[model samples]
Target: MTIDTLDIAASPMPATVPKRSFLQEVIEDTPGSDPRFEMCIQCGTCGGSCPSGPDMEYSPRRIFAMIKADMREEVLKSNTFWYCVSCYYCMARCPQQVHITDLMYTLKRKAVREGYCRKSTASDAPDFSEFFADAVLKYGRSFELGLATRYHLRHHPLGAIKMATGMGLEMMRKGRMDLTPRRIKNVDQLQAILSKAEEIARQEREQGGVA
Candidate 1:
């Protein structure tokens, strides 16, 4: 008898199985997600438009299916979530209007919160996001020089020096990039609004609403 190595029966089962569906759990946890999460038509449009899809462990469409299949750990740990560049091509091309980019961002945040973010290039996105957010919170505007300096110094010091010598100097000379972050005159009011927004978000999360 000839063996069919590709047969599902030949595969080993996991020791433990999840008690709940991953997709359902996520929907319940994140009410802010597009209501069309379950409406994907398995089309390849989103993946085709994604510039980073070729480098991802799972394409956008495949990740949606994996979510439906309750592959929680695998999906969260995958580099696909972190690889999204927020170019919006996937979301714009999705026939189902699934907000693919938003879902990808949600996944990235969740992965980081759950301690699943990889300590490699896959982590650069979240690290940069943090620096950008901090810069905004502190100065009411993104300080590109500060963000770049912090990111590259922490990640690639040698490459940072080379970049600083090249594009950084050009930007400085053009007066496009500021060495010091400028605070908005009404920054205190902005901070108050931000604090209130955070409070509302916390309340919503506690109430099982969208985060």
Candidate 2:
């Protein structure tokens, strides 16, 4: 499907100030280190299949090219990183086995590290992944509506108020939003699992020595 182009000319470019090179810090020299980027054949298959492409300041194709050129600041500051819906359409369809979703995630981490993220506000906020992780860290499983409400309140205070005053009340009236979070039995076990996984990841990073 062909998507109409947005006004990319009006989009904000990265600041002229010099910044540290996160590219050298996060990516490794090994194969598949940036597999999605390296393997991309400029097929535009990823961009063609992406549902969120229209809303993005740059397509997945352009973003990968920017990364290949080590244009870290320009790529990170683009709206594409924040707009990815994680639908995995690009990943599922890539003939080169490029993990587009993972690449986007890596970009997001770099953006956050550089403090180039959007602030939590009524309309705009950071990604919901952090909120989801926090909920999972607190409880074993996610409570759908509870998580949503908590995220809204924590990030978008005004949005939360409006949500509560309107949609929240409606949902509560319909018994759709649960007030209490359902705890998984033996929550400590899950906590231990999560902690172990995190430790393993850290060890892998240290050993791999990939930035």
Candidate 3:
């Protein structure tokens, strides 16, 4: 499928500012990453497939175009990644197998790492993602109760107590909550793996000349 192109040079922007692009970053970090960005036909399949597309500032198709256009600030500030539900419908429906969902995840990581998430109204999403990652790295699995308590205490103290009071006992009675976290038997090995992954990522960023 062929996609029509627009001349970005005609867009209203200062000529002195060099255009920035992160398509390579997306391909490097996204799971099931693919570099065949040109395969996108602008058919709206991914946008239509997304359940939360309507709530996003830019749909997946438009985000792809922005990426190609090197609209880094706009794309990074967009709520597109936060709105993704990981349903995989977009990826499943894409004729080009573009891995749209994974790309969204990658964009979310980039937004957080580069501090773009601080300017977004959807800061909670990145905060939750970071909290979840920390939890997994520490416990090998999400410690639900601990995570909830920690998150609320840091982000919403008043609401935290209220929410816990309302549902905590009920959840415990139903055996839905555990006060203690269960640690995996091979936690040390998992930590080693994570450390190695981080080391590799640090090396890649250095090699790519990106801070």
Using TM-score as the yardstick, the better of models 1 and 3 is: 3
**Residue 104: error of model 2 in Å?**
1.6
Error of 1 at 165 (Å): 1.3
C-alpha lDDT (0 to 100) for residue 188 of candidate 2 = 92
Per-residue lDDT tens digits of candidate 1, residues 1-211?
4565566665676556544476765665554645578989999898899898899989999999999988878888888978888899887778888867777877776787777776434766678888999999988999999999999999899999999999999999998898898889999999999999999988986775546
Q: What are the lDDT scores of the predictions, listed in order?
A: 0.82, 0.73, 0.82
Better of 1 and 2 by lDDT: 1
- For this target, which candidate reaches the highest TM-score against the unseen true structure? 3
136-164, model 3: which lDDT tens digit per residue? 99989898888888888888999999879
Q: Looking at model 1, report the run of 10 residues with the lowest lDDT sum.
A: 26-35
Quote model 3's TM-score: 0.83
Ten-residue segment with the worst summed lDDT in candidate 2?
118-127
- Please give each candidate's TM-score: 0.81, 0.72, 0.83
Candidate 2 clashing pairs, residues 3+ apart or interchain: 25-211, 26-211
Instruction: Score candidate 3 by lDDT.
Output: 0.82
Ranking by TM-score: 3, 1, 2
In model 1, which runs have C-alpha deviations exceeding 4 angstroms? 1-20, 28-34, 119-121
